[model samples]
Target: MTAILTFFTTLACIVTLLPFSRHPHWAIRGMDFPRLQFAIFIAVLLIANFVFLNKQSQFTWVVISITALCLAWQLWWILPYTRLWPHEVKETKESSPDKQISIMTANVLTPNRKVDKLIQLVQIHKPDVLVTLESDQWWEDQLKVVEVDMPHSIKCPLDNLYGMHVFSRLPLSNQEIAYLVEKEVPSIHTTLTLDSGDKVRMHFMHPAPPSPTENPQSAERDAELIIVAKSVAKSNQPIIVTGDLNDVAWSATTRLFRKISGLLDPRVGRGMLNTFHADFPFLRWPLDHLFHSQHFTLNSIKRLPPIGSDHFALLTKLTLSPTVGADQTGLESNTSDHNWAKEITENQSISVNDVPQVDNSK
Candidate 1:
């Protein structure tokens, strides 16, 4: 039993440390996702070690030291999102229907087919804009009920799991469907004119994850985001980027993206608001996200009830108030951040023709 426990502890420690290597391989990059779960495991293992190990041998001491280091590293990355840290986005001091924009983003898990559940939520929430990920033709047909009210939309439905559609009550202009990194994957970009005649630039993306079955590397995902980040950095317009990022809130890549784009996450110091793996209570994490620029302040954020999909929908209301920017501060990109962004972007910036394609066929 002690031997087994030692092996588990060592493996966990290695997983915790691997993300630091800046490698994009699926196994190495995946270590960035489950820091919270690993932290819990570290605590349990420490307690087990104390209870089960009868002797204070050198091996036991070494195991304890490794576990402690792993615990510290995990906590270092996750602590910023907890209440123990200050919020990066400020709450709205006041909000009005005209100045406020409400959005609901959901990953419908393509095959789930629980359209009624999502429709019911939309009826109740009545958000100004709705974004759905992993939405194929079937999901598009099911969501047409919302089109009657949200007349303006950008639909890029595909049989591929990367399909996405955006439905909105507000006016949409300059709409584009971009295959930024991979040919099969598409991202939505457009300008939304709110009720108050305010225009907000919006980018909706559901980049393929770093997984054995998917791209097998984080390079494309990171590059896609950095490309967007570069655009956002150059734009003076108010911007909102939302979707299932596949990357976590605290990952190094996400931090760099936020810094470059100057967008703020409402989840910081608010809550983890885990939105993925809706069917599993034990293995869920925050996969869906809503990020906006300093021109807006958060009114309220809600993680809606599950709709038989793998992810829960996220609804957020924000007021377009530039005055709020004075009281708020966003992460600023440093020299290292810029260099890392450049490195990742250059590494994955292959032309569509030159890009190595993933075999979608199982």
Candidate 2:
């Protein structure tokens, strides 16, 4: 019993401390996720060590103290997502329908041939804009059922699982497909003309995540996000960027992205809204995300039901407000942030064509 508890205690301490370093490998950055799980495990270990281990030994006290401290550290990053912290984005008070925009972003797991559940959510939510990732030609064809309502569309269907398709009810223009980091991986950029005659620029991105099968390092993902952040920071009007960031909200990369982009996360003060690994509650995390400029206020944001994909649908309704920006101040970037962004850009760790292609079939 002592051996088991000691092994887990050492593991938890190492995992908790790994994310503090600047390493951008998947193995290190991946530790940024599951702070909640770490907290839970640490809490369990703290209790188990007390009950099962000898109290006379100095090792028991040392383990308990370190485990307790780790629990507090994990909570420090997680409490903001809960109800404890004040909302970074203000909830909409103005009841202006014309000035509102509702969007739904979903990852249609390539091999998951279930469209009915997703289609049903579309009907129920009736989002003005729908973005689908990991969608192939077949998934594109299946999604056309809603095209009659969402007339403006951009499609880039690929078997590589990085494919993305965007359909919007509002008029769209200035469309451009940019391969920011990886040549094969593409990001969709366009301007949506809303009913209020307001032009909002939208950048939809789904950079390949760092994993055993995907890109092994976080350099490509960081570079792509940093590029988009610089672009978003320059915009005077409202900008909406959404997709699977493949990184946790609290990660160093994501925090840097927010600082450079000057975008507000609706989930910051609301909830984590875990959307990935829909089948496994224990493994679920917030892989899918939406970030927007200060001019927008959250009208509604919720996690829709699982739609035959590994990710649950993310629906967000936001209103264009002039006064809300004062309440929800955009995260400002410091000199350190600018230097970090420049470093990621200059590294050029991953070539444009460095990523090898993968099979589409599951």
Candidate 3:
């Protein structure tokens, strides 16, 4: 019995560590499963160790050593949060016509029937822009009535679960659906013209989750995000990317996305706003995120109530600022400011050649 327990425990631990190791396809699907597996293994090991110690087992030393090693590894996973989070330098260029923009990102969980709850939340908050992920034809139909109030919208209703819909009080320019990872999965990308006539590019995405039923790997998802990050970095306009990323805030991939895109997360100094697993809050982690370029300042950020979905909605308010001089330009903006804007010159040319082409065929 002890041999069987030890073997399974060791196997779980090894699998847990495999994602962190340099694997050919590390970021394809959901990483939470491996993380949960590791947690379960540790819990089981702890219980076994306690039982063995109480009985004064002969192999207590071996058990203790293994437990200690696992604990150390767990600690390693937590150390990154303690380090200084990256911040963008403030820009001097003042916004032409400063305006406050409120955005809400929600994953409505396709099968969920709480349409009224979602509607109530939307009416209460009255955000300038609202993005919903995992939306389908049914979800879209339910939300159609609200479009009258929003005036402008981009709807891509699909049964594939990757369908997304965006509603905004502001005007949308150059709006298009982009297929970054898979053909069936599409991300909404557009420039939102605020009341002040200032334009900011907004990219809303919800990639396929990594799991056995899905792509079973996370490499493609990670690569897709990297492509988006690179595009955001090259943009001369202020950029806001928000969605249920299907990844944790503190994960290695999220950090890399921030660095490569030169965008700032508002949650730094603030607590982890876990938005997933709304039914069981304790098991949740922050999956929905709002990342903005250095040219915008955070006015406010908060997690909204459960709207009969597996995930909570994230609401954020921001202001826009222009870049200073050429020398001061490109310096990252602070994560805390209410009005932030990065300067992206219209003349700057970026070839789409570097981005990975999605294979529409499975």
Candidate 4:
């Protein structure tokens, strides 16, 4: 019994601390996703050690202390995502209809054939901007039925499953499709003219995940996020960065992205709106994310029902209240933050120009 407990205790501790390493390897970087799961494992082991292990032994106490610290460390990163923490993005008290915009983003899992179900949600939600990831040409053709209403849009459909599409009812200008990292992986950048004539810069990305089969290292994924963050730092307009980020809300990379971009997350005080792996409730994380500048306040952020995809759709509504900044403090990037972002991009074939600019012009 002690042998079994010790084995798992040691294993859990490794995963708990692995994420602190600066290595870009998948095994270490991927540890950032399951912090919640690791916390649970450590909690159970601690409970067992307290009840079964002989307290008189110095070794037993050491084991208990280590597990306790591991559990606390894991919770520290995740507790902020729960409702217990203060809201990072302020909620709108009274949102004006003309100043509000609803966005819906989903990773439709290219092979998913349930086109009608997804389209039904689109009709029901009627979002101002709709972004779809992992969509193929077939999905794009099926989705064309709604293009009449969303006349302003961009589509990049590919067979490789990195395909992306964005349909907007609001007027879109300076629309661009750029490959930020890998040549084949594409992202969309554009300016949306709201009903109030307010122009907002929008970026939709689905960066490659760090895994054995996909990206062997996290450098590419982190580089794409850092580059975009750098660009957003220079923007004067209201900004919206949304997509399947392939990273958890609590991960270091996500935090760095938020700091450098000076954008806020709606999920900071809300519960983890875990979207990925919709088929498995046991394994899920908030991979699909939407970050915005202080020019906007959250009206609502929710997870929509599954539509034959491995990820659940996300719907976020925000009001363009420029006054929110007076009350809300953003995550400002310090000198160290800027230096880290620069260091990460130094090796990559990335520059300020690599990040597409979406100015308010046709």
lDDT of each model, Cα atoms only? 0.86, 0.86, 0.69, 0.91
Query: Runs in model 4 with CA error above 4 Å?
Result: none
Tens digit of per-residue lDDT, candidate 2, span 1-362: 98898899899889999999877888998998888888888998889989998999998899888878888998898887887778999888875888999999999888989898888998988999999999999999998999989989999999999889999999988787778898888889888887998888898999989887888899888988888887677667788899998888877798899999899999987898999889999987788899998889889999998888889989999999967665677568889889989888768654323221111111
Worst 10 residues of 4 by lDDT: 324-333
- Please, what is the TM-score per model? 0.93, 0.93, 0.74, 0.97
Query: Residue by residue across 1-362, what tens digits does model 4's lDDT show?
Result: 88888888898789988998979999999999988888888999999989888899999999999999999999999999899999988889998899999999999999999988889999999998889999999999999987987888899998897999999999988889999989999999988988999999999999999999999999999999999998988887899999999899999889999998888898998999999889999899899999998899999999999999999999999999998654676567788888888988886879878988785533
lDDT of 3 by residue, 95-214 (tens): 343466889999999998899988898899899898999899999999987787798999998887888999988888778887765779788888888788777888888877666677
**Candidate 4 C-alpha error for residue 94, in Å:** 1.4
Candidate order, lDDT descending: 4, 1, 2, 3
Alpha-carbon runs more than 4 Å astray in model 2: 349-362
Which regions of candidate 1 deviate over 4 angstroms? 54-59, 350-362
Where is model 3 poorest over a 10-residue stretch in terms of lDDT?
338-347
lDDT-wise, the better of 3 and 4 is 4
Q: Please list the Cα RMSD from the true structure of every candidate, rounded to 1 decimal place.
A: 5.3, 5.5, 8.4, 1.4
lDDT of 4: 0.91
Identify the superior model by lDDT, candidate 1 or candidate 3: 1
